[model samples]
Target: MKLLIYDHDGQLVELEDVSAKTLMLGIRDAGLNLTAQCGGCASCGTCHVYVDNAWQAKLKPPSELEDAMLDVVEERRESSRLSCQIELTKDLDGLTVTLAPGSAFE
Candidate 1:
């Protein structure tokens, strides 16, 4: 399984064989500076990312709680998702996401 993360500078970080980890964990492991203030508990929108439209359906639907958190993020888009809420799996191979501007590393 693999994932492509488009960072704030538009650099794409490729992750391979990253299974059983949340998207937030994958990003953190990649050395990007996304803020997961509440860890992977989805309590904060600090890990927000915009799912590439082509890969949106491949991810699990966000829960009500996640939707609420997303609402507070001014950069939220129709494709907005909390990385912490997304679990990496073989089915998510090739998943691509762009870091939402609001959640970009400072």
Candidate 2:
């Protein structure tokens, strides 16, 4: 349950063995404000974050709905993924993700 968060302020923090919350929830619980406008249904892009290069390939690819939703995200990138769509798991212990500026809830 480790989390590598790239904060909106350009800082990276490594959080270890967090609970099984959705990535968005975990980020919020960790004291970061990430927007989940559509809840965790994968319908909104406000929760978008760019997963680190080394960990991207290890994640499950986005669903077609997620892919479509990502188009609305500001600064969308090849590694962009909706945090709400990401479920915490043991295999994601070292996951690194970059929080897009202006993407999280202000």
Candidate 3:
């Protein structure tokens, strides 16, 4: 499985064999700045990302907690998702997401 992330700088970072790790960790570890203010606790919308529409059906529906958090994000969209709430797995191979403007850690 691979994960593709569009960073704040508009550069794409790719991670191979993405499994177990959450999207937030993968983004940060790839040297991209994503503000996980609550550290993957779903308490903050800082880790928000816009999951590509093509891949929306591949992911599990967001939980109630995640919905509440996303509701507070000004950039919320139909594709919006909390990076911390998505875990990487083989099923998500080729997953791609764009960091929401307001969620950049830097």
Candidate 4:
């Protein structure tokens, strides 16, 4: 349930045991403006984020559809992943991610 947030400002914040929330929901609940324009259905690339290398191996890889959608995101990178696709878990306690610039709901 721990969330390691890489904010728009390039800062890392660790949130502890935040519940079984999706990454996008947790970000919003934490007062961050991560966008989930398609309502967490994995439709849009608005919630695009870059998973830290250290945690990448621990996460489930994005589906083919997700990888396709990520191509449309601005500043897409090798580590890019949609926040909505990331489910919170105890093993992800120290998971780190970076918010893509201009991907916030605002």
Candidate 5:
């Protein structure tokens, strides 16, 4: 699967994933600044990302828990999502997401 990530500065980086990890794990593995502190549990909201508008409708809506987590993020927007909630699959190949500011790296 191919994942395209836009960092805070808008630099685009392409990543490939053979392991079916969630988007959060893929970002962390790519050595980006995303700490993803809660792993894929969707609790800490550290994996916040903005799905590219063109790809937004392709993703499943956030779960109730994920929605709640997103609500508290200061940078939340219509495109904001918890990357941990999105498992990468063939369907998600070529997905693009931007690192949102609320992602708590520390």
Candidate 6:
């Protein structure tokens, strides 16, 4: 599967091996920045990302924990989501999202 991630600079970075794991795990395992300090715990907003508008509805609604966590994201948008909460499924094979401002490797 392929995941197109737009960086803070609006550059496109493609991740090709999205296995059956959370989007954060796939992206991080690919050696990308995706901070994700909370490690899929949905407690930190560090994994913030914005789902491309066209692909927003294709995802399941966020859980309560994620919803609460999102409230803390400084750059949260209408389509903002925590990558740790999204499962990579065949249905989302070509998912596209942009890493929010605070999501950095360092």
Best by TM-score: 6
Best by lDDT: 6
| lDDT string, candidate 4, 1-106, tens digits | 6788878888888877687478888886787768778878789889888898998898898999889999899988889999888888778877788889768766
Q: What is the TM-score (0 to 1) of candidate 2? A: 0.91
Q: Tens digit of lDDT per residue, candidate 2, span 1-106?
A: 6898989888888777689578888887787777777778987678889998998888899999999998887878899999988888778887889888657676
Clashing pairs in 2: none
lDDT of prediction 6: 0.88
State the local distance difference test value for candidate 5: 0.86
RMSD of 1: 1.2
In model 1, pairs of residues that clash are: none
Candidate 2 least-lDDT 10 residues = 97-106
* Tens digit per residue, CA lDDT, model 6, 1-106: 9899887788899887667488898778877778899788998899999999999999999999899999998777899999999999899988999888888866
Q: In candidate 3, which residue ranges exceed 4 Å CA deviation? A: none
Please report how far candidate 1 places residue 69 from its true position, in Å.
0.3
Candidate 5 residue lDDT tens string, 39-103: 78988888899999999888999999999999888778999999989988778889999999867
Per-residue lDDT value at 92 in model 1: 80
lDDT of 3 by residue, 24-56 (tens): 888777767888899888998899999998999
TM-score of model 6 vs. true structure: 0.93
Off by over 4 Å in 4: none
lDDT-wise, the better of 1 and 6 is 6
What TM-score would each prediction reach against the true structure?
0.92, 0.91, 0.91, 0.90, 0.92, 0.93
lDDT of each: 0.87, 0.83, 0.87, 0.83, 0.86, 0.88
- Model 3 pairs whose backbones collide: none
**How large is the C-alpha RMSD of every model relative to the true structure?**
1.2, 1.3, 1.3, 1.3, 1.4, 1.2
